[model samples]
Target chain A: MYIRAAAGISPQSSFEQILADPVPVTGSRLQCMEPDYAKLIDPKMIRRMSRIIKMGVAAAIQCLEEAGERMPDAIIAGTAYGCLGDTEVFLQKMVENDEQLLTPTAFIQSTHNTVAAQIALLLKCHSYNNTFVHRGFSFENAMTDALSLLKDGQMKTVLAGGIDEITDTSHTILKRFGLYKKEPFPAGNIFQTGSKGTIAGEGASFFVLQSEASGNDYAQLTGMDTFYKPASGEEIRQHISAFLERQNINREDIDLVISGENGDMKNDAVYDMVYQTVLSGIAHIPFKHLSGEYPTASAFALWLAANILKAGKLPGGIQTKKTPVTVLIYNHYQHIYHSLYLLAAC
Target chain B: MADLKKQIIAQLNLKDLKPEDIGDDQPLFVEGLGLDSIDALELIVLLQQEYKIKLANAEEGQSVFRSVRTMAQYITDHQGKSTA
Candidate 1:
């Protein structure tokens, strides 16, 4: 499959911002620099949508617009924390109203598939719509579904995206579990700090995926693979090696590796080992500092890699000696959901 | 009636509209306020929660939610009769 077009609303304002002047984040969480949604979405619909829904719909519409598409054959969204704000509101109302007379808006918008459904509603599209809530592997699963649908001749154009949002309630709860750095630090020093926890980040990235090249595609999605709970760093190396072999590409053919190191000592150890072993000497860049660490954060990594291949330039701070032709994106969520995506310039 | 319009706006999340923008005799559903079935459900919940009025059936919603004036009249007639 190929990435026909890619657009995202991440912690950074835009890919151009990432290349020109990436802002430094200093906090426990990195929030998306959302656009004026009134311009991107209908004001009436925007009134009812929660934060994540607005971001997801906007990113998807932007991707479709970039591809010059009105309606995609399928819309698949992956979200781990789907519509958290609406969920909080719905549950709060349930308690406040003593389980009676609860308003339908919050409850209706609180579902995991609400974002995907909302996009379909806006498009008047009754095509195949699906949402994957597979925790860390959510976005990867959605992409895989899109690839399958396209490869099987089931669909021509598919809009696949990964979306997740951070809410005060979710952030507070995850903080109690020690998921974020207790002390504020510079985002640029995420790797240097060598801390116990990573910063919380959230974003929405969407891609227009097609099986055939459009001649203007961002990059060809060479291959994707995932593993769960690999026993050791050597096991991860073997997985990467096997994946590269299946793609018929040698480790030497890869010009860049987008690493998923998130500044956590425990979370980054595997990446450190991989760098020393299988992926050593590969010009690399870490993305977590730019897009905080979230379950489906690899979506942002894929979006970055695709854009980098399309632009033929690395982001401002990332120094690479060569213009990358083949890029490898490796991301894992706390070492639980490991995924590798290979991309090449079209 | 003004408070009822305020309640309707708040309950339905009609952020773009003000109470004064809605006429007292204007219909609350399609061809009037452009609300759909979902907004109708929300208006029902608004009546129960804010006015202490329980709608007897889905059919009653057609007449009761016809206009802000009708909703206010319904509330005046039924508010204390329903249990909270």
Candidate 2:
């Protein structure tokens, strides 16, 4: 199926602001600050949701609104750490209170599937509702599930998305664990250094997908592949060749390649193989410096790809060098996961 | 005292609480406090936030957060409690 309507909420901006510029990071170290919850969620319910759920709900609603539909056939979401802020709060309570008295709000909100479940409850969507949490491949896994379901001819329109939010506590933990760079790096200039760690980030991106193309269709998903183990440069190059061959497309056919270059020297090296070997001639764009490295960060890249396909104009911030983008191959690799997606203008 | 009621309401984040309405001997959980599990967690924060008493077990919390009466008594019992 093709992506009909899309909406995203990141540290960058909401749907409206995103449509205006839609560029890669002009500076570096981008973090998705939250939008106003009162605008997207009900006042009564707003009191209950954590930042992640609120962002997911807002993006989901915005996608539906853009699609000119209320409920999709299925709603699937992916998150690496579900509501970690609430989880931290709950755990603190457990540890401090010594298991005597407890509150259920944080526990209820901390569930991995809370975003999907909340959306389902609000829309009363009794159809297929699933949430995947497999670290970096969470969003890719959800998209894979959606594609399989579409192939089965069971569902026509599916709403799929990925979202993750960072709290102060989680940020501290990640910093302590070396998931983030120790040095004080400006949000801008993140890509300048061939550093080891990328800046932490959070955001939500949602897409309204259907089996049939619509007037607002952005791109068609030809193929998607995910690798579990850490692939070396040669191995990654071979895998890309195989993947493109399976889709009957060559490296030259890929007009644009959005590489997940998060400024990490080791991780960014993975993309170098593709840039130097496979997609040497293709226009390569990176968004992690702009969006920051979140679990579902690829969703924003998917949004960028779709918009680029629709606009037929490469936004200034998104360009590595000036070139027209017709066919985009989005390559994303995180710890223990690598995903490649081929999207072409429909 | 009315001050105690106000303190409880403010500490627990009982947005619906009315200072004058909370009797001295009123319950704090399902009945008077009307707090659910999340609120109870908040109450644990409240204990730290206010009285600086830290109960490290759910069983201990059950006793501490039983009622306004019990809570005040616990606070009075464990004077000079420090925050976690």
Candidate 3:
């Protein structure tokens, strides 16, 4: 259950910024504050990788370095829309050439497993490598699978992560489906967006999880579960209790609840329903203003949870009790993919 | 091939290098420009996307992409055959 190490790149700053302070985002769509590539990759190789691939590789390398392991026993990643930028480029070529000729670079790298496979290639790791592509449950699926692997003794140390990207073409395409706000609003006031869509964002995160305890364990990843389209909010509330029951904890014992509150009036009502049902008195924190909305935004939520446990620094605009112990991460996507994660301070 | 150099620089995103920095016969992979296998693939994409010259197989790209001069020669030889 111990998370040995963690690393990520996000819209705010590097994953270490929680120890200091998070810089406020300015635009509706938050773009990642990138690290210098020279520090993490070979220039010759990075020139060929798309942005999402680069981010995933960098974070994976960071995790390996932080965990002090050159080769992990396994690698697992979750992504919803993988390598969209490369896919867009390939599609553009097919459109322009009228199917006369098309290159295979973008097509090859556009697959959902490419992120995990690329990491394995870079690390020369031939262990258990897999990827999950189930929208909001993507990262949670990875976490649950990683824990299962550890529990079953298939592996000892594993590199588990989640990655997703939002490209210009994807932004436009998803906007037609009302996935992002057409008008601009101050990112800090996302809950005040009187709009139909949420801000689009992209990020990648990696965690080194181990079966035994480590010197740098951030927290114990106690439990993870996912529920798809519950019968009603009552079902969701019951499911929350069920997850806690599996972990042998009570609802009132949860010190803080991190909720995915992307501010779409219709889509956010589900989270509101959860609050009214089960998490009314719980100290809740919101992160979509900083990380924005992505299928794997829950990865950022996990990253935030680990940081809170390790650094004990909370960013502004959220309040909590004297000292927190148990944290629950609750996220849902499009009212279809719902996930729950429990973490305890080690 | 002045335009070709600029196209290569922009397409491959050599952020530190400008178009004029590349000579006509400069090698693109490993030694001359420090590009790698992925760049070779992107060069294939460059041919299909920009010049409409499609190499039928990966083996066909080795000589055609040896340098900017070779790439230009391939394009010139396949002038009328371009689909674009």
True contacts kept of each: 0.89, 0.28, 0.72
Candidate achieving the largest DockQ: 1
Provide the global lDDT of candidate 1 against the true structure: 0.92
Candidate 1 runs further than 4 Å off: none
C-alpha positional error of residue A195 in candidate 2 after TM-score superposition, expressed in Å:
2.3
Candidate 2: list runs displaced more than 4 Å: A14-29, A185-187, A317-325, B1-84
Tell me the spans in candidate 3 whose CA falls farther than 4 Å from its real position: A14-21, A25-27, A183-187, A193-195, A317-319, B1-84
- The full ranking of all candidates by DockQ, starting with the best, is 1, 3, 2
What class would a CAPRI assessor give candidate 1's docking?
Answer: high
Models sorted by lDDT, best on top: 1, 3, 2
User: Local error of candidate 2 at B18, Å?
Assistant: 9.0
Q: After superposition, how far is residue A241 of candidate 3 from its true place, in Å?
A: 1.0
Per TM-score, what order, best first? Answer: 1, 3, 2
Model 1 over residues A19-100: C-alpha lDDT tens digits? 9888676888899999999989988799889999999999999999999999999999999989999999999998998998
lDDT of each: 0.92, 0.77, 0.83
Question: Which candidate, 1 or 2, would have the higher TM-score against the true structure?
Answer: 1
Give the per-residue lDDT digits (tens) of candidate 2, residues A168-284. Answer: 888888778777776655545666676777778788899988888886787887788887775467777777788889989877677788778888787777777778787787777
lDDT of 3 by residue, A1-346 (tens): 7888888889878535644566665554778778887789877667668899999999999988988999988899999998898888888978987874566667888788988988888887899999999877888888888999999998899899999988777888888888888887765688877668888888998999999988678888988899998878889889988888899997788988888888888778888888887787788877787788999999988888887877665666466675677899998888788888899888
